[model samples]
Target: MTVTELAFFVGASGPVTAEGTEVINQAIEVQTEWSTRNAPSMPQGRENRGVSFLQQIEDPSVYLLTAHWASVEEHNLCIAAPENRETLSKIPPYFQVDKIVYFHLKDVAINSTSGKNGEISILQSPIISVGRLTIAAEKRQAFEQAWNEVKGILEEFVKPNVVKNGWRLEKENETTEEFVLVAGWPNLEKYRDFAQAKDFERYQSVLASFAQTRDLKCYRRIL
Candidate 1:
């Protein structure tokens, strides 16, 4: 799957306000509505599998749109259409254009999907934890090795939930530092508790140390 991630951060000059956020929500809803339509401009045999709008838990002003496509070519064709391009352009006012991280990810490897309880699977998990680690280009191999080795260590923290956590590389980007990490959990409280624990830092230290910048945020699926 070609997963396209678009993180929209709050505009620098504009103050975060309820009215402005409502406008932003309405603008994004337009894109969501368009993706669900069966329009001729859409590729013949390909269609979007899912399009979700996620609100950042720590910062309500930030939002993420995760869209799943069959391939990069299909994704390119869809957005190049005039109408779809215009639909996407409606969202820029709500975000800092330069800060937005728009990229594609491939070769995703996530953990088991069985729920923490019984029925609530990873997809059904209330929070999706996304961590973007910007590694120094030279440290890529060491970073990947360190992260891969700690998967078992991470699993130890999964007391109840499915250990649906793994990493993926960017499918298309000029820079090589885009390593996207994802995990699933029931709520913010559970994640925060574990994040503060020494075990998490034990596994996370090397990964963070290798990266020039690390951004970690938990998001609630709103789509």
Candidate 2:
């Protein structure tokens, strides 16, 4: 199972200053080394598919770290290992550890169109949206069923703006009923114009029918 770790962080003192971001980057450097290293720590080591740093489009101060892993069990094992503890301990000075919240979602392939120089198309895309969709408690199965009804229709409705789109399942233990939806787009204008378009009316209604609340924001990858 492919799992993607999403950690939301803010600066300890206030909005992260330029210098604070630099300090955090330095710490990330250490974590990067530990993540990429070939070591004999665990029986079957964790897989670090790729690491990304994202900044909120509306507010640059809010930071997010996205990491891909093999499974949640493997992720827990790697993070708890003594080899990685030192790096974790250093994060508090630059970020508010108490306020940090995370969710590890089951990720689908976020790859690109094949080419001579292929890459993760999502990262290269101008902006991506990470949507936090909350449904009624214990309504995971119901929500998926509802979405399946409109998935194909809405996919076509959104058109080329939604270059790639999929919902990442939030584990049962993480939250009562939440799905992390990731959408790749070339620009924000095209994405925002969805509401004004007459075609989106019915689909939006279908979407709102199942979703209790949605907190979605555009983000650009900085690292």
Candidate 3:
């Protein structure tokens, strides 16, 4: 299955100024270029891949680097390569490394009311909400089942307001059980409207039953 890898980076000490943001964006662009040139030969079941960079709207000091790979093994192979590792190691000076997590796409629910595509992109949407949770190991199955049931409801509830909605499970992590849900909207007001809706509360309640902790934040595309 396809996997999405997310790396969160926090700015050093003080607030990240405009200059700092520019530097970080440049670094990400450079990294993308270098990775594409130095990528190791792909193993079986690994072909399509891409990467993106995002900055938090509420907190410019936080950035999220996203990678879409054909599969987790493919991503691992690239990470294991000496050239890739060396290139990646040079990125840390741009920001403080917070955490790296991987996720496998579970399902995607799209609202039928609008003709707009559900794919998340800055060109298509102005705001994005990233909801992260650590689910109990024993309840993983139940959590996924609940998501299957709730995703459609979520799609209907948000209707034309949401551009994209999808869920993903953590690929592998020893410290915690994590899952990520991302929703895209045309603007902050529309997103805030969804947050304040009763359906969102119900959705959260269902997730809370299986989750140990949750963190949700909004981000704007920077590059």
Candidate 4:
């Protein structure tokens, strides 16, 4: 099973600057270098794979990095290594380590034979996804139709392996209703291509008239 870790970079006291950027880069470099060299010698589960970085629009200073792993043990090993220990010592200077959350992500679509309801064994962590939508009151039905149609298209046309899990919720956050899609792939390249595929274009077209904008976020899971 594939595991995930969400790392959040929250500035401890001041604004992030050029100096701060360099510091952060150096820290990552040191940590990654050490992990690459030491992972193989560590216990079976704690080896290092690589980290996938992502940042949201709300705050540029605040960043998210997701590190994928062959297994939970390998993920744990990398974090506990000596290089990561040294890097941790430097984190407070540039930013505070908010918290580290861990997650055992499951492919809900693959496990769902009927595709009516998805069962996600989500680990209790900080990597929760929230989406907000603004739909006119008079066009509520129209909005729902659009969302469902797009979801149906995604389910039918896109390859099942491309999507890990899918969920639909009404009034999930405030006034927004969203159909959420989750995917787990060997690499980001596969997901990026499918997002730009023709079928995906058609799915988005269904919601084009009613959608104001779609906000997306990818968070690292830390526990």
Candidate 5:
């Protein structure tokens, strides 16, 4: 039920940098105010969620906001609130949000070398991957076998640049039969090259043979 992450990507068309920052800062303030004021009524054990924004180094026009929520019901309640609605309405003039994508994060790795009191350093920031695949009832085994092969390549040949990587099967409660891959990378260029490589394409072909439907995307942390 946890909301591991909710990512909002700012699109190409939007206000200039200074204006966008102003809008984001305002949104943060409003969200914080609302959360605090409604804490008593908010779902128990879910009031300590956090949000942050990250900007892509290669593409300044694109930025991401990631929020961690306690549960799906809490997220729904927050979105449906009148104050939250008002806050969302005021954002378009300053920023264009592509889609509010949701994810359930799996913590693949954490480095505790910093040795500070509860001050863990993020050696590599989070990366989010979203995808959906066709699932055939009778061909599940075949599909799994193919996926395993591709995963092997990913682990051996593709994951060196990834500081950490892991995949999760989606919940039956969701609308789509989506599977998510979460990874952390030292650099985006390395992940970009790995995705477009010939070997990766070959891996995809192998997967496509068994998949009747497919959707895929890759995202880097901006906030």
Candidate 6:
């Protein structure tokens, strides 16, 4: 099944205090509860699959809030709901909104045990390296082919400690076709080790050949 992800980028206007953090966390919990409750009946027969709140370790004040839905239409339905809008309205006062991006990513390739019963928690590998890219229009097919190869290579390198290495594509067309790759590692030490390895170099080389624009960042799961 395909998943639609709504990503919210936000940061504190100033240094976030203990109280501010608590408020943000509570707000997220409430929002998730509401969404989960309304998921089954949402438009387009959508389901609220999951929700996560991530904080950027490099910049503690910055955060990434992601919610997974059955499809893009379902996500839009939730957004259009008055209750959902009300919950969302409560969030902005707590932080400075940066930008919001939506991705309708289908899991094209994954490990055998990716979505099996024994799934690793975000807390296990709190650090997630997120790579976002826009593929050159003419090279889309080639890029996807290269991605399949890259996924196989990553399976060999980022295993055990690296619980998840997921690749997803954006359904909507921007200036170019967009994709996101999220690699989860136990800690910065493990992540750095993988990055410095030869396999990572190969991965980067393969990506560079077809990627028109690439942006990479790291974030820690806070909720």
Strongest candidate by lDDT: 2
TM-score of each: 0.70, 0.77, 0.70, 0.45, 0.57, 0.77
**RMSD from true fold, candidate 1:** 4.9
User: For candidate 3, which ten residues in a row score worst on lDDT?
Assistant: 41-50
lDDT of 3 at 189: 82
Candidate 5: C-alpha RMSD to true structure equals: 6.4
Total backbone collisions for each predicted model: 0, 0, 0, 16, 4, 0
**Ranked by lDDT, top first:** 2, 6, 3, 1, 5, 4
**Candidate 3, overall lDDT?**
0.60
| Model 6 pairs whose backbones collide | none
lDDT of 1 by residue, 177-197 (tens): 667767677777878777676
lDDT of each: 0.59, 0.64, 0.60, 0.48, 0.52, 0.60
Q: Taking the tens digit of each residue's C-alpha lDDT, what string does model 2 give over 79-164?
A: 77675676677677778888888767765444333343433355556777777777766777877777666665544544443433
TM match of model 2 to true structure: 0.77
What would you estimate as the lDDT of candidate 2? Answer: 0.64
Model 1 residue 129 CA deviation (Å) reads 1.5
Candidates 4 and 5 compared: the better one by lDDT is 5
lDDT of 3 at 150: 74
Candidate 6 residue spans exceeding 4 A from truth = 18-27, 35-37, 41-48, 108-124, 161-175
The local distance difference test score of model 4 is 0.48
Q: Where does candidate 2 clash, by residue pair? A: none
Which ranges of candidate 1 are over 4 A from the true structure?
Answer: 9-48, 92-99, 109-122, 159-176, 196-198
Please provide, for model 6 over 167-199, each residue's C-alpha lDDT reduced to its tens digit, 9 standing for 90 to 100: 455445645777677666667887777767767
Q: Which structure is stronger by lDDT: 4 or 6?
A: 6
- Which has the better TM-score: candidate 3, or candidate 4? 3
